[model samples]
Target: MGFHTFDVDRADALEDPGRYRFCSREELVAALDIGDGAVVADIGSGTGFYTNEIAPFAGRVYAVDVQSEMHELHRKKGAPENVEFVAAEASAMPFDDDELDVAFSTMTYHEFASDASLEELARVVQPGGRVVTLDWSANGTGDDGPPVDERFALADCVDAFESAGFRTVDATGRKETFVHTARR
Candidate 1:
């Protein structure tokens, strides 16, 4: 993560259901288009909130986060049986090349939106695998999420993914959030 990471002290905010106002579990699942036996990873998973939402639909779900405290919080929250904890950064994960069927992030795209990180995603996800990202948009009013100055616009995300060798499937820049789905 390049910008300020989520503070572990305010982790309770991550668990609040109201946080779903900007991005919901349903929208994320739809964007992912998970297969019956898909192996997926939830990058920057804070407390297995969205990770738990996707685990029942996927064969395996890796909860990947750079902070051990976040994983610990997830552990305390009791994740699903199929959820695996991965304490690693987005740009440098432990997974083998072309191993993942899909990878996604919720409100975390801005933190790891560098060339190295997007390229790492392109490297890990197999061909035809999808990469879904939902985050605070630069187009949004500075009311609910991070400042617009730190967020990325829809075109920025599309360019980054395309540059990293993924093909855009769909993209929507909404009021406060932007969702993008791309295929490797």
Candidate 2:
């Protein structure tokens, strides 16, 4: 795992619509490039913000998070018909090998990023499946999101995923964030 988990007390901030300026739903959905029936997992799926957005396009979506309270919060907020909540850490998920068609994380990669997590993702995602990550970049100024010192640069993400046997598909370092898609 990475430096720190998000504080549940401030989780309401996660639902802010203004966040779309950094990562719009259209951008994320396009980045995922999933079929309508894809089995997906939203790692660190906080309040199900992005999970709800992707649920309509997926056959099943596992909202994975380490915090049980986060699941409860999402449950109270309501989930789509195809959504299921799983309280688990990123490094140790319960899916069978190659079970997921795709898995993606938004803004939470800094919290669950590790060699073990990347390897686990490689194990769970089917061959040719994708893992998409968008998170605050170390290259950004310390103006928003996590402090710069706590964030990882795009190169670090690419190196870690490549080391875990994933092939990089797309990687772009934007102004305040980075998005990387890797194939398992």
Candidate 3:
């Protein structure tokens, strides 16, 4: 199972520009490298921050969040035409098998990381599909985002994905976070 969830009261902070210090929009999008008209899901999407950023590039984007309040908050912000909010947990999504061309999450991997969740990801993403994850790293200094103890190290993430039968396309641990791309 995953760790504690983010407080919905801090949903406003999800839109803060300072968040780029951990993972920028460009980096996340580039890591996904989806083709035009690709179906994607933003797992654990909170306030649709990164979801909105990648919306224009996708044919459809499912903003999957466990908290309906986050979806309501994002709805108030006006979701992109292609974005649809789905109230679902990472371990149990409503998507069909091989439904998504890509699935990505920013800073929320720790909240949902589990064998079941990774298996669910492998089931949802199609063969040759991509899964991009950018989050606070366990190997980082306690400077920002979640505490290091609660975060997963790059190796742990890589092993988890591989164990889930996905191929690691790219993985890098930065100063305060790690970005990983896995191909199903």
Candidate 4:
């Protein structure tokens, strides 16, 4: 299904505030180890949460989402000079191969329509570029989070990335969060 039906305005309404508090933009960015002059892409960057934080550290950031309303919200929020909003599907990013130094998606991989999204992510990053993912931990218990089946387990995510030609570098579970860092 296309992402046009996604309600950008009500996106956060689907989330549990208390559970997401630990996955705050500040904490996620710090964990990324983002370097100066890095080029990054925040796929499924709803509302520019992670995009806004990483923009300052990176030379350029591509905030990509399929929904126009989502991109509209990101634009209205006024991203930094280094950030550019793009309307594109997660499985078909409009970026050249080896163009980005880092690619990140927060609470988004599970929402991807299929495995194509993982292929697209691996295609865009340089051979040594890193891919970082933070999503709901599958153990559940988060404050009123999405149904258990809708969430992607950390192991499944890692396997998908590895199958897409990414090498798993780290995997950790903290609080209600699952973080994975990999290299393409």
Candidate 5:
């Protein structure tokens, strides 16, 4: 299936929400290593899952998503004062150059139509800022499950980030899910 065919509504209502769940929100926040006054952007932030979780740790969070319904649901869920939702295409963020201190996306990289999204990611993050990604592993063992072809391996994500001018920092082996950290 083509990337544009992805149905955010149907996908959000899947029987197994755990498949899309983050491993440990606190761990992710720690890995980000942001100070209390840093600005973070959560790309493909669905229903404020990571947005709300990371808000308490950062100065502000930009919850960017292509789906307005998801953004509305995120707002209804009672986001923190530090969170802001912006309807954004994955390939083009709305922020100015180097405006963000950290960038995060959970279970979202594979949903992008092409490398345009990575370019956008690199564009908004400042030099030496961190970019963290959590996604379904390509090992075909996730409980929430991703479309076979849409799933990406750790290496694939690392290469994409590197090509976009990010330097890989660390990656969790081939677990059902993996976390990758890179720096611009």
Candidate 6:
């Protein structure tokens, strides 16, 4: 199992521009390498912040969140035309086998990182499809995000993806965050 769910009441913080300090749109899009008409999913896509940044680059972008309230907030914030909101858990998405060309998650990975979730991602993303994950690192100082005890290191992400049949393309551990790119 993963960590606890983010309290929906504090969802506003998810949209702050200062959040770019951890993960910027340019780096995220570059990490995705999304092509025209490619199918993508944003796992734990809280209020469609990063989802909006990615929608323009892909054919279909699934704004996936387990909480219905999160989806509602994204709708209120004006989700893009091609963006479809899916109220589902990261370990149990509704997409078909090998349906997604790419998938990504921001700081919310700690709440959904699990063996089952990684297996689910392997099942949904096509072979060679990229999965980019950026989240709070276990090695970080307890400055921002959840407590350091709840986060995962870049190596932890590499192990999880590898166990689920993904090839680790890159793994970087920053001061307060970690980014792991894997290919299914």
How many clashing pairs per prediction, in order? 0, 0, 0, 0, 1, 0
Predicted candidate 2 versus true structure: per-residue lDDT over 57-92, tens digit per residue: 999999999999999999999999999999988999
Please give the range of 10 consecutive residues that has the lowest summed lDDT in model 3.
1-10
Report the number of the highest-lDDT candidate. Answer: 2
In model 6, which regions exceed 4 Å deviation? none
Q: Report the CA-based lDDT of candidate 4 relative to the real structure.
A: 0.77
- lDDT of model 2, residue 99: 97
TM-score of 6: 0.98
Q: Estimate every model's Cα lDDT from 0 to 1.
A: 0.91, 0.94, 0.92, 0.77, 0.79, 0.93
Tens digit of per-residue lDDT, candidate 3, span 1-184: 2657899998889899898877777888889998999999999999998999999889999999999999999999999999999998898999999999999999999999999999999999999999999988889997898777888999999999999999999999898889999999
lDDT tens string, model 1, 1-184?
3456888998988899997887888888888999998999999999988999999999999999989999999999999999999998898999999989999999998887899899899999999999999999999997987888989999999999999999999999899999999999
For each of the candidates, the C-alpha root-mean-square deviation to the true structure, in angstroms, is 1.1, 0.9, 0.9, 2.7, 2.5, 0.8
Higher TM-score: candidate 3 or 5?
3
Task: Arrange candidates by lDDT, descending.
Answer: 2, 6, 3, 1, 5, 4
| Residue-wise C-alpha lDDT for candidate 4, range 43-114, written one tens digit per residue | 788888668878888899998887778877777767899988888888898899889899887877666735
- lDDT comparison, 3 vs 5, better candidate: 3
Residue range with the least summed lDDT across 10 consecutive positions in model 2: 1-10
lDDT of 5: 0.79
RMSD of 4: 2.7
Model 6 lDDT per residue over 1-184, tens place:
2657889999999899999999889999999999889999999999999999999999999999999999999999998899999999888999999999999999989999998899999999999999999999999997999999898888888998999999999899899999999999
